[model samples]
Target: MRENKSAVLNRFFSRNTFRDIIDSTDDEIYKSVILRYVKNPENKKNVELISEIYTELKKNYRNEYYYKNTLLNKLLLGVHSINTTVALTEIPISKSKADFVLINGKAIAYEIKTELDNLDRLENQINDYYKAFDHVSVITCKENLALLENKLEIINKPIGIYVLQNNGSLSIIQKPLKYSDSLDKNIIFKILRKSEYESIIMQVYGELPQVTQFKYYSECLNLFLKVDLDKVYELFIAQLKKRTKVEKELYQNVPYELKFLTYFMDLKEADYSRLNSFLYNQFGGM
Candidate 1:
């Protein structure tokens, strides 16, 4: 398969595709990609087809999904336990969207630059993440490693780097050190939801801001700015850690290829049962 066909693989691995399977909804993407890519898919279970396609994507394409799923599998699940760690995807921070974020004791933003991706906005993306996070890293394939390293040299902060080798292993090219000089309180405040910052205000100030509904937000911001930035960073990490929690047993039984999707799907027990049934069933026709 050519690299330009990544969109087809992207659709095949998307949340919408798996949502169709769990909800028993029909989508043409499933049948089209399966028939086009997998041989004798009719006889194989959905899980097997998924594994085969994932392997192909890893080997040939190495698109953004492959990088994220691999990180979640290798770093989040492989190195860190789900019970203690939280992984967030596609989080908007300042001018850029953070590709993947891992929050254990400290939060680090991972910006993925696959071979298919360009570095036109990498500097801006890295700068945006530092406002809300202390540690930041860029994960890219071996082809882009030298360019990324050269790019980082002129950038003032200590940003770490990792290479996703062709063999599907994450290698730490440069370890990131904690840098807090760029932490902006207002940017950090904006990253939090109303309830999150409110909780922080109550904890630190012991009272919610008392103002009109229109002014309440600004007043809360003013109050938040008064708190120490380091303290604010700690509270921010604590709040984000509560956002996404997964069902341990259900997540464990899910195929490795689908772990990233399953983690973000916010699956209920009934949904898990439905997905399990779908995975075990042969394609038959769809």
Candidate 2:
């Protein structure tokens, strides 16, 4: 006879830390579960059965997970302080529900996959997301990292990659890659408007041409708007050599539109407000 899998899940969820595991310390519980299951493979069939039941629960509770992850990613990316509007569970171009959409004047779609599912669907979902959104990301646990690396070779599109453990800790496994010829104007504009253009310049140049400009722009705009300009400048210049080398070897002959970006980094303190105003006008400002 089939065991009452619900009973097993109920028992698991009833633990005082289950909610904490799901809410705050997911990676710890995830590692614990894997370790416990590995140590006690005698109960392998039971574990698989329980996992199946949890899959059903996850499907039913996907919305809850989606919202939770949005909140989680927001905190992880420090989105709240960036003045960007964030939305959750947006629809993909496929009209299937995307797990999260972060719009801080730029559209970023996030799809969350748990341990129960293969990442094949995620690859397809991210592809669809890119068609409808400006950026695409997948949030999964470390157990799925191998799968993402394998898929990355086949899907050449630039997509943000993040690991969201059972403990709710998020680590950027793969920063967003750029697949388009067009510069992400919104991100570019934000970086130009920032007081820390010098720092933004250094970090942005550190990445490969396809990724460096967009990622650096987004990161600088997202983080430096409130920090002291001097610190930002120091940090930016400190990494300049590394960025310069990366640009020469990996992103030679960078597009003219993006090259204009380098100019913002060299501006005088008195010139920042005017340069920002110029950039805002050029990009039609967010």
Top candidate by TM-score: 1
**Residue pairs with clashing backbones, model 1:** none
**lDDT for each candidate structure:** 0.90, 0.45
Candidate 2 off by > 4 Å: 1-67, 70-78, 178-286
Sliding window of 10 residues with minimal summed lDDT for model 2? 243-252
Predicted candidate 1 versus true structure: per-residue lDDT over 1-286, tens digit per residue = 4644877888989999888878884567888888888888989998888888888888778889999999999999999999999999998899899999999988999999999998889899999999889999999988898888888887878998999989999999888889998899999898899999999999999999778999999999999999988899999999999999798987899998999989999999999999898888887554
lDDT of 2: 0.45
Model 1 is weakest, by summed lDDT over 10 consecutive residues, at 1-10
